[model samples]
Target: MRRRTLHLAAVAAAALLLAGCGTQRDGTASPAPPPSPRGCPAEVRLTAADDGRALCLTTGGRLRLTLHGSEDRPWTPVTATGGALRPVNAGVAVRKGDAVAAFEAVAPGTARLTSTRPLCARRPGQNSCPGVQRWTVTVRVTAR
Candidate 1:
């Protein structure tokens, strides 16, 4: 009787453990882990490849965006919609080089970031082309 009880208890504990280990077999993502002791997780990094997509973040999360430009047509500085995402720095994309911007999720809301450059590269004293290239991403922030 004692051995049977122990075996049953062990089986019950194993079942509970397996149930608690959630899996994404349904093609849905699990929830984000809770923040660390510093009240935020590591900064979420983005690149030019992320353009035109939407992202989700939690309050107190950090975001970093980096975009590279061609030799002649460098990208302009980046901008944020503000309110939900607060700029951690000047928020301006670097000029004449790879652009970078950083922000922190402050509130539960939506925001957008954008930058642009002339589509056609021009030589010195040349008139710039009317066409332009743009990069943008939308961010949805949720409360932690």
Candidate 2:
């Protein structure tokens, strides 16, 4: 009887250990989800510059722009309005070769950046050109 009781106690302990392993130290079942990306918004805000040359934004801020294209249709930068805002290193390609470019506010002023490339639709054996696709984003940087 004592042996049986000891065996039962060991099994109970093992079961409790397994149950606790799934829980956090604070007793929550799992960790919270990570916060959304910084400097990215669901909708782009269009603000005009005082000089009518660029859009307005805050210094030290960033703007995230995403451009979609086929695997063979990559985007290239056409123009950057001012020196206040500059593109970050290199653009990143996501699903199906879609590209994402990030621009950082470097100073307190106005700026704009334009990117262009031929838009194409790729089929199994051929590609169709719709025309040149141009994208422009302007910013007026203010002191942080």
The global C-alpha lDDT for each of the candidates, from Candidate 1 onward, is 0.75, 0.56
lDDT of 1 by residue, 14-71 (tens): 9998655422456333343344564444357888876665667888888998888876
RMSD after CA superposition, every candidate = 11.3, 16.3
lDDT of 2 by residue, 5-78 (tens): 99999999999986545234563333222223443232233321111222355676777666555566666633
Model 2 residue pairs with clashes: 55-139, 55-140, 56-140, 57-140, 81-112
TM for every model, in the order presented, reads 0.63, 0.48
Q: Whose TM-score is greatest here?
A: 1
Off by over 4 Å in 2: 1-54, 77-79, 89-97, 122-130
Specify the highest-lDDT model's number.
1
